[model samples]
Target: MTKTRRIPFVVANWKINKLQSEIAEFLDNVNSKVPSQTVVETGIAAQDLFLADMVRATQDSPIHIVAENVHWEDAGAYTGETSPRALKDIGATYVLIGHFERRKFFNENDSTVNLKVMAALRNGLRPIIDVDEDMSKYAQFMDAEPSVAQVASALAGVSVDQIRNITIAYEPTWAIGSGEAATSEQAQKAAHLIRQTLAKLYSPVIAEQVRILYGGSVTPDNASALLQQPDIDGVLVGTAALDPVKFLELINIAKQPSMPGQFDTDEV
Candidate 1:
C-alpha cells in the first residue's frame, strides 16, 4: 500500500476494569501525552457505564470514544444492555462487536452480532466487528481457513453499504491475554485473507480502502514488527492500554520503520 493509502488505527479495549475516577485519570494522561495526530488514529473502548465520562473527556481532542458492546434494539427492556441510539446520542463514534470475551461469556452468536452491526450503522456509529476466533470449532464446521469470505457470508444478510462502513479486527482468540502474539508472517497471512475476502464480497477498491487491525498481547516491544507487515494496518490493544505511559510507548513504537524491503509497495 502507498503511504497515502495507509489507514493506521490504535484502539484500546478497556473492558470492565476501570472505575469512574480511574477513567478520568486515564483520559487526562492520554490527552496530555498523546503524540502528534500524524502518527496514528487513536480510539478507546470503555465500559458502558463510563461512556459518558469518556465522551466528556475527549470532547476537544482527536481521540474517539467507543463502547465495548451494544445491543441491537434502539431502546427496550433489555436490562444491563446498552442501546446503540443512546451511545450515538452521547457522541460515541464506534462500537466493538463479537469480541472473544463477549462470545465466550455472553453466548453472542454471529446472527446476534450481525444485528448489532446493523444497529450501530443505523445509529450512525461505526462497527468494529471481531470475527469469532474459535478455531477448533471453526475447523469442525469448515474446510478452509475462516477468512473475510466467511465473515462476509455470516453478514451476507446485510447490505453492501453496511459492509463498507465496518472495519474488521483479526484477533486470534488463543493469543489474547496469553502474552503471545501472531508472528509477522502469521498476521500478514490472516490480514491478507481478510482483504481478499472483502475483494470477493464487494470490490477490490473497497478491500484496498478497508482497515484491518491486529489485536492480541500487543505491546510497545513488539508493535513495530507487527506494523511492518504490509497487510497489518493497525493494532487493537488490551491490557497494556490500561496504563497511559505504556500505551503512549506502544504508539511511538508503531511509528518506527521496519525491515528494509518488507513494506515495498510492489509486494501489495
Candidate 2:
C-alpha cells in the first residue's frame, strides 16, 4: 500500500533571519489569522537562537514549530552544536538538513546529511531534507553529482516507515533568494524527478508516501501556481514567510483544491 502522506504542507524556512522580538509579535497574530476554510500542515523554521521563543509562541495553536537545522549526534564531544535531544526539549517537531547554503558554506556533503537524517529520525524529529541542483555551474556541481544522489544518500538506511517522517524539499540553488521563482512547470518537473528517484531507491508505495515541497523565491503571487502541480505537496517558503500576512496568504493559496491527476497517475 502506498504510504505517501499526500497532505498539503506549507512550511516557512526562516533561515538565519528573524529577531526574537519580531518572532514574538508575529506568532501572536498567526494562530488567529490562519484560514479555517482550508487545511494545510503549516510549520515555521526559526533560527537556532529563536526556536524556543518560536515554540513557546506557537503553543496551543495549530501551527508547528521547525528548526533550521540540527546536528546528527544526540550527544558527545561535538562542541558548539545543539543536540537532537535539545531540539526535542525545546519543542521543535521538524528540522532541515542539506540546504544548498549549508553544503556550500559548511562543506556538508551527502554523507553527513545521511547521518543527520537518521539522527533526526532517531530522536523523533521529522526532517526536511533539501536536495537541489547547483545551477550556478560556476562549481560544475550538477555534472559532478545530481541532486537525486543527495536524496538517495540521505535515506541510505532509513526504513520504509521512517521515510514517511521525511519531507523532501527540492530547492534549486538558483531560485533561492533571487526574487525570481521558477515557472510552475519547472518546479513540478523537479518534484516529479525527485519522486521518481524515490521509487527507484525504495518502492512505488514509499515513493508516493514521501511528501515533496518546492522552495526558493516562493511568494504569495506564485504559491498557487506551484501548489497546483500534481506532485508538489507544499512549499518551503523563504522571503515571504517572514511576514505574517504574506505567509498566511501563501498558506491559503495552498489550501485551494489541487487539480486532478495530482496523484493517481503512473508517471511521476
User: In order, what lDDT does every prediction score?
Assistant: 0.77, 0.81
TM-score of each: 0.86, 0.89
Q: Any runs in candidate 2 off by more than 4 Å, and if so which?
A: 1-5, 35-38, 134-147, 259-268
Please report the TM-score between candidate 2 and the true structure. Answer: 0.89
Residue-wise C-alpha lDDT for candidate 2, range 11-114, written one tens digit per residue: 99888886788888888868877654235689998888888877777777778888877898999999888799899988999999889999989999999999
lDDT for residue 24 in candidate 1, whole number 0-100: 88
Least accurate 10 contiguous residues by lDDT in model 1: 259-268
Clashes of each: 0, 2
Q: Give one digit per residue, the lDDT tens place, for model 1 in 1-268.
A: 4433444778888888889999888888878666555656788998787888888888877788988999999998998889999999999998998898888899988788888888898899998988745333433323243455337744666566666667788889888999999887777777777776676676666666677888999988788888888777788999999999988887666655452212323112
Top candidate by lDDT: 2
Error of 2 at 48 (Å): 1.4
